[model samples]
Target: MINTRPRLAWHRARLLTIGVAVWAAAAALLTPVAASAAVDNPAPTPLVSFTFDDGMQNALTQAAPTLKKYGLTGTSYVNTSCVGMTTVPNTCRASTDVPYMTWDQITQLQNTYGWEIGSHTVNHLCLVSVGDDCQATKLTAAQVDAELANSKATLAAHGFNATAFAPPYGDYDMSVLAQIAKYYSSMRGFADTGNNPWPLGDYLIRNIPVQERTTPVATLKARVDEAITNKTWAVFTFHDIRPSPSQNPDDYQYGTAELDQLAAYVQSKVAAGQIKNVNISKGLVNGSPNLLANPTFNNGIGDGWRTDAPSTITADIGNTGSFPDSARSVKMVSGSAAGHLFSPKVPVTAGTNYLFKSFLNVAAISSGEVGFYVDEYNAAGQWISGQFRKRENTRWVESMNFTYTPSSTSVASASLQVYVTGTGITAYLDNVQMLALAAGSTPPASVNLVTNGAFDAGISSGWTTDSASTIQADGANRGSPANPVNSVKLTATTATRHLFSPQVAVTPGTYKIASYLNITARTSGEMGFYIDEYNAAGQWISGQWKLGVSAAGVTNVDLTYSPSTSSVAKASLQVIVQGNSGLQAYFDDVRWTKS
Candidate 1:
């Protein structure tokens, strides 16, 4: 095993360095008064601080590059005793997880990237009194004193100006706080699902854990959006900056793509001035003015945007069908195959989240795609990462709204690229937007497999069902978020009841069956959906599969089945219900998607 990565070794340091609080709080932990949102202070806008806990080397190799590239900084709380040691010699912590950062790298972050250095206890002691980790038995007061003092001392001795302390494991109490406050300006913790509304007190700084596998990009964006809307600060805690390694990947580890995607969005949002990006100290500041030079496309294309070479495409400042107030937009025509229009470099914050949108009207014959692209770069001015995309409609499509994300942390700038397979195709682009994403609607499902899937025809037109069932198109309670107006309800008592669909055309391939089942009530046996295949001879060729639902409130009915046999002539879908008396079920959005 390559033990080179930092293991957050503090958990193993134990009571060896109980050195008392002699680091002098006034000299080491006094936060600069210049930063916004001091204790109990309010700011005009919300602030979000990006912070990494533990001394992983990836913090430098992986995270710092993006952070520095985006003109952003972060705070990494590390255990001093394990400093520079790939794996600490002795401690309760696992050997594989004890790779602490070298003092050299720590200094590099502070001196080079404006990153804040913070303490996380001498060696991740369980704060004796809180008594959570490191052993069932709590450490003595003397031991706790030694851990805190020695930890801060190590950072101070190594030329690191650490102003905050993150209590290891997010565990702390009034007893721990009283002690920590004497040696630190603030102590960061991971206790809240939401952002912390400041002035954050000296103790209990809240942080959301952006674990790789558990938290999604959409989820992080929502948190940042919440901070922006509520005027609160969002502080984050991370462990391994890189993705889960092939060997012994823990929940604390996430893929670089996830981090990069998040960082790219943060940088974009920061550039837009939609939210304030800060290090640990400045994390509670008022927001800044929008950083965009020509957000509304009012200055004309030449004013700010950088277009492709003139030979391949033609472009001009256009006003036809423009958005309100902004009487102008950029119009482009491809003489050959493809063309691109780009924006000036937009500085971004690393490890952040954002949403983007654009209003466009495309016209004339088209064959290729027209979407946005991001040119990514690192702080050292090296191109690093990016993403490109186009809306589905490029042929005679107009007055359309395009929504997307930069999709990479290294995304340094965005561009509008139009590709037309057909020569002489024209596209109208306007009001390119880089905005925050609010809690949006759930995405619609894919094309369904079964026809008359919803029975919106007011009746089960081509469907076959036992005479006991009926389609309830009336506004009775049979409704789901997906299909609110139509459903086929079945009430069964003793005898089994089934609703089958007419035989549909089939080919040798895989198909997905998805439906929603809502049980008004159930003493359940079972109600399910099924797929059956028959050969050309009109006889069952032994291809059958089923998925069932047993509970209430709209249970998901989804499964994948394949009639791989070329002999398949046709296929039929059915819903069968059986069980005790008085079992009522409503099913809707019955779809069979072919892949």
Candidate 2:
């Protein structure tokens, strides 16, 4: 609702008038000639940075731990005067009381977690008033110098060499930029919503805020995707990380779980080598390196792997090919005890998260289970702990991934293993991978599994109607404005008839099914959506029928369905209508997405 256009335009104008020379000089010193390519030119590698403002205490207690779980570190911009304050400081625009991180805590963030410490002025003063309080533009040039120079000095006194700056409230003008350039290498702006180009505008570095309530995890992932596609740097700003965030947007609070989810998503991208997560000081870098050697077993199992139980576990470099890549796979057979295939010992940092993944094929498992685990060791090579990550008790073929953070700081190394624990279990494992996560990682985004859900190509594209009903695409009545030019209209006889969508392949997870329907006419019965489940063998097993509605107007049909059994490997969305001869309805914009 707030118009920030005039302020942004003015900011740009001032940058050209007063900050251009400073920015050009800094760019020449920092960026290479090759880095000044066209904005459309893709970056060699996409970069992302997690940055926090105002040095909130939760940035240490909550945000740091969450980011560490994904093996990530962020930049924390601290207001020197606000450090250790239990009440809202007069320099801060915020009205509510919130604790700020202490000097010791900030040091730990830098020394222990490898986070970058940045300046946020001596007092949280807005350089120029846009609309909020704490405006300091009225103050003399000497005061502004103290705000900038003094804050950097304080950080230096505390043994932190701060190099980045973020203007409070993103309120700044030409004078502010000139002063900021004197104190820091880069300055981040609050309202700049898009990713930064290869040769960044260091003086006004753009960032997207991770606000609670308004900003969803999906939106953040999209930003990451955009950066990867455009080959740019994506910086996200955060404030308080709380277990229960206030609904007020002014609080600038986000839930801890949401942060974890975003972190997981970013970690997944890092694992896939789509983007590199870095701090503000580190412009761009390579992504997380794959720790496990010979992940595909292409060079032979002896390269970096050994069988713990040689009698039951064998390296099958022939015949059995690896998943995703045509290489080699290892096999394990259950014996009296578990058989283990251990990867080479990988050095691990304490309190940092790691992701282990492998594709597995269970040919047969009559009684027991096959598990993916990690065995931890201390610096002295003594066994510290063994963690059971994930397992499969049934016959299935899929990729299994699990994240693990060393429980004890003493843990120095880990060996990933695939073991068969049950009797008569035979499984093939391939394409094993282990990568350290950046701090604050989350799971990957899910996709819509429904085929031709919008009926764009016509009813026969991916739908089948029972003999008792006739289905046709209706362009005139598309059910909703968001829908495409066509919606499938089903007219059924006195008998109940069903129009079914193409069978969608699925894994073991929750799915959301939604569709818009318009019941133009109906005489006796109701109409709604149903999800029919199928086993791995493509045999119909069961179904979940939603409560049918008989209203003769546009209605939304939504349902959340999870597999009732592990065998459910496929599902189909069924639009069922039962009534008299005149039963007619329209269905459009059907969607089936993993939740």
Candidate 3:
């Protein structure tokens, strides 16, 4: 087996023996000089945290003993909903088997083995692709919310206090991470390069996968040795622990011999006091960013900025030729491998909000946009993208601020960049800053109500279908001008018409419309909403808008259009149903807004 030493100061110590016989080749190749240095001064030992996911039975019956034999601690994330929920014990046919452990078994393992339990999100879903967790379809945003909040309640009820979460499918984008971080202290995901053996803390940590195709026991031992030598924690994650494992598609079973070998290696480390089993979250708090010792930014005035990555510097004129002060517009002529420069790491608390600011300028030679982005990572090495960018004209300095609510990590770090887009506009930036905000003081804004239904009070804020069927408010906040509605629906025996328009011309711009409604049946006709506008001729332009429905009750629908439709003097928002059939039904709460 090829065993590589860890990256650390060149150091070495006497070959400490605890158990297994030393291979002649391995021993001879050992650097005596390096061992001597380690004996003189050892590097700070790092904390190791082990976490497992998808509680396979084999993990408990097979892997547990091995882990225990090594005096190691492990946390397993489980899907509570999967317990006793299916008759079929295994669903192992897919390329990757996705199965859940029975609650009874999971409880037994946790209670008897001192294992930490965490939620895997109920109904396991990809939250980023979908919008809100409650209202999404396959797994509605509501369902996702229920999965997280309800699972917590269930675990607590069952005496399991789970404070971490492993996003379902190991698939998450910035938006999903933002939402999930709201609930979990530590989030786990699949392994990635530069993320293996994961980092510690609330942010993305590392976990190495142990699969069927993994290297043999000897190689695994060598790697473990290297990790110990470097004082690095190596977490080995697997799905199952059995030979020729069946039924579980994701099973990465180990033979009895391999398990014994791992146990022995762990025993040696414990005997030598070379290893300490610790919780993953604790590791993050203890690990510190490798800050640059003499970070400098050439592009800023007086070189006041410090960044780990290289930055571009350019020259210009401003305060230099003026009376008050000497100011030269310094531009970062280029970006580095790490993107832009950021301040040294600062401690942050989860559940709290924070504001980060940086000074930037746009030069006359450049144009387009000049802005910044917030960069954060999750336990799985996933980056959490921030919102909004600051723009400036070619004239002066501007401050860009990013505000966010943190999750489990104690300190969240960010990078700031002053970039110019388009053409003929170059910008200089400096004085980047970050500040934590108090919770509940303010939250990101949300869309509460939108409507085109405008009518004078007490004048029947309903729809008038001239010569057809007229509609009135239900007086229960339904279809009322004052009370924004959600759905608009009506049931009538004959053909009906309604006059619908925003008391004011609908604001001109690209907009989206959403509402819910249903009809008893559209046996021989079509059901749809309508948008009315006017052409150069000052005549109303009507377009057929339709949304299909599945069953009874309210069917929510969303539509989009350009501002040109509402830019005219008397343009409006209208919903129309046209056909020769009777028993027409219409719905309300129709709203038009931007995405």
lDDT of each: 0.56, 0.69, 0.45
Q: List RMSD in Å for every model shown.
A: 24.3, 24.3, 27.0
Model 2 agreement with the true structure over 1-595: per-residue lDDT tens digits: 1111111000000000000011111111111112122222122358899999999888899999999999989999999888877656534443246788789999999888889999988878767663446652475777777888899899999998888888888877655565565456567889767888753555667899988879989999999999889778899999888999988887889999999999999999999988889898686221234677777777666655776588778767553543235346777888875566767777776645566666666768776567666777677666665554556767765446566666577877777767676567887777676666543342322244777666767676667776523777777734432233577788877666677778888888877776656677867667756677788887888776656777675554457778878888887877666647477877776667786
CA deviation > 4 Å runs, candidate 1: 1-42, 87-95, 129-133, 245-250, 284-595
Off by over 4 Å in 3: 1-44, 47-49, 85-87, 90-104, 128-143, 193-201, 246-257, 286-595
Distance from true position, residue 122, model 2, in Å? 1.0
Question: lDDT (0-100) at residue 581 of candidate 3?
Answer: 39
How high is each candidate's TM-score?
A: 0.40, 0.42, 0.39
Among all candidates shown, the one with the greatest TM-score: 2
**Per-residue lDDT over 460-571 for candidate 3, one digit per residue giving the tens place of the 0 to 100 score:** 3434444333344333433311122322344443553443544324445655555435455554544534555565454655443434343442243456655454435434
The digit string of per-residue lDDT tens for model 1 on 348-436 reads 54323223344444555333344454454454445444433233333432223223333455554333333332344566565454432
> What shift in Å separates residue 353 of candidate 3 from its native position after superposition?
25
Provide the lowest-lDDT 10-residue window in model 3. 7-16
